[model samples]
Target: FGLTRDIYETDYYRRGGRSFLPIRWMAPESLRDGRFDTLSDVWSFGVLLWEIATLAEQPYQGYGNEEVVHYVRYGNITLERPPNCPEILHKLMRACWTFSPGDRISFRSIVDELVPYENEDFRLNAYYHTQPHSQQETVLTDSNSDEKDLLLVDDNASEQQ
Candidate 1:
């Protein structure tokens, strides 16, 4: 049997409700209502990114599930950028956590963003290149203009997907 089947057959699965799951992984809308879809998965992906970036640190470490749910629903609290997380990756995670489902970035865009990091050699060189003050300044200056264009492009691409 597949992993899903094995997990589903467990006693924990037989016990209904989300008591066993972490509230940090749940999207705000999913908590408020029963609605779940790709957008919800996107939110979960953002939480997963946080976990990976923090070396699997439990999210909202000191908060209870109810407290987290309230904070997420009313205060819009999201995972803070981990100490060593790449700015681009953190940006992608933020995009995934957009409050409105329609505004959240698509998984395809997430894959696109991660494609460059997949090549270890390129990543090393790129990391070094990006570290220069001049390069950082250039990126900051260009990002605002690029963001407008990217939003339009991402909207079109997400619609097609």
Candidate 2:
């Protein structure tokens, strides 16, 4: 139901008298004041889900690193839901991307939301948007997480049959 590995411990990047950051995957707080916690990890988790739903497509595909930050900060923009993703999963991703870390869903709540799909009835693999939409598998995960994220899902989440 879960997995964990040691993250190569490092602070925000610094070298050559230049600063580097994984701005694309970083949460607002991390970008703003260098704060980090599991909630920030939640933000990264949302990005991972986007990557999966889009079949490994880049997050914020056309935005430059700086543009990604500008949109998130000034415009309150987040990655749009993938056309092939289910509403519930998109909702979960949105929750993870909430601007306030405290408002973001906890890893435990994510499990509660996703557990309903672990049934043998639903297939567990997701396909590209170009493919037929009916045959989706729902069980999911992201790295750097305390929880094992599994399966993308549909509205059948609470409406499980």
Candidate 3:
């Protein structure tokens, strides 16, 4: 649940293999004893996709590291997208979660799915830009020191989680 470099070398599913902590936002392969390509990264992104679709709650909030590990290993969590989330996006999210390493969907396919969504997002954005709201939206652009503090805070918060 927190950021740790320690390898989760025991497979929670009894799959008779070593496990590893998902490195930050990367996949299991990032901590494995080999090269981790973009595919593995996609797998990790799938978890983030779940988080975003669920209104920013963590992928498995309130769970300890061991429980999160078990949940991912055994496919226990059924990620439910928010009501307004499109089905195509949900399918793409599921595609990223395909278990077999070789069977996972390609990044190109992901882009194909995302292109339409991005276009829709763009249209919505353009519409919003044309309208006048009561107050101007404020964006906090982080400075280098702010970024460092953010990382530190994230590290601390993750530990607490």
Highest TM-score scorer: 2
Those runs of model 2 whose alpha carbons end farther than 4 Å from true positions after fitting are 1-19, 121-161
Rank the candidate models, highest lDDT first.
2, 1, 3
Task: Compute the lDDT of residue 106 as modeled in candidate 2.
Answer: 95
Candidate models: Cα lDDT each = 0.73, 0.76, 0.60
Error of 1 at 41 (Å): 0.4
- What's the count of clashing pairs in each model shown? 0, 11, 2
Candidate 1 TM-score to native: 0.61
User: What's each prediction's TM-score?
Assistant: 0.61, 0.62, 0.51
Give the candidates in order of TM-score, highest first: 2, 1, 3
Name the candidate, 1 or 3, with the larger lDDT value.
1
Winning candidate number (lDDT): 2
**lDDT minimum window of 10 residues, candidate 2:** 6-15
The list of candidate 3 runs beyond 4 A from truth reads 1-35, 74-78, 117-161
The whole-model C-alpha lDDT of candidate 1 against the native structure comes to 0.73
- The total of clashing pairs for model 3 equals 2
Query: What is the TM-score of candidate 2?
Result: 0.62
